[model samples]
Target: MADPVSVDVPHKLGREAARARIAGGVGKLADMFPGGGTVEEHWEGDTLHFTLSAMGQKVASRLEVFEHHVHAEVDLPPMLTLFAGKIREKLAKEAPKLLE
Candidate 1:
C-alpha cells in the first residue's frame, strides 16, 4: 500500500444540494463497484464528505459547494494504484451525471 491520492471536485449548488448530489453519486458508485464496500457521509459547515471502505482498504473523498462551485476530494487507496485512473475517470463521469 502507498499514500492515498486526494481528488477534489466542484459542484454548483449549496451544502444541502451538494449533499443530495453526493448521496446519489455514492449510490451510483456503490452500484458500479458492487459489494466493493460501504459509503459514508459527513458534514462540516458547507462541505459534504464521503468515505468509501472495502476489503480493508478505504478511500476518503469530500465535496464542497461554494457560492459558484463545488469542490470535491477523492482519496485513492494504495491498493488501487493500478485501477486508480480508471476509477477516477468513472467517478468523474458518474458523479456529475448523478447530480443531474
Candidate 2:
C-alpha cells in the first residue's frame, strides 16, 4: 500500500450507467497487463473490487461509480510502486474510452 494511486475518470453517464459499463469492461482489463494475466473481479454495491496478477506481481484495485465520474484506485506492491505514475496515467487515459 504505497499510497494507493488513484484517478478520476469523468463521464456523463450516471452512476448506474457507469457501473454497468465498468462491469462489462472488466474482462478487457486483462489485456492491459502483459501476458494477459489473471483478473478477478467482484462488485460490492457501487464499487468494484479487482485483483490482477501478472509478471509475478499482484495489483489490487477499486472502482467506484458516481453520477458524473468513476474513481479508480490501484494498490501496487512495493516492487511496482516505481511504475505507479505510469499506471495512473494509463488508467486516466483509457477509462474514458472504455466507458464510451
Which lDDT tens digits does candidate 1 get at residues 10-96? Answer: 566755776676565665555433235777777787676767765567677676666555555566666667666766666666666
Which candidate ranks first by TM-score, i.e. highest? 2
Clashing pairs in 2: none
Clashes of each: 6, 0
- Model 1 earns a TM-score of 0.66
lDDT computed for candidate 1: 0.61
For residues 11-72, could you state the per-residue lDDT of candidate 2 as single tens digits? 99899988989888887776665444888999899999999985688888899998999988
Where does the lowest 10-residue lDDT sum fall in candidate 1? Answer: 27-36
The regions of model 2 sitting more than 4 angstroms off are 34-36
lDDT, candidates in the order shown: 0.61, 0.83
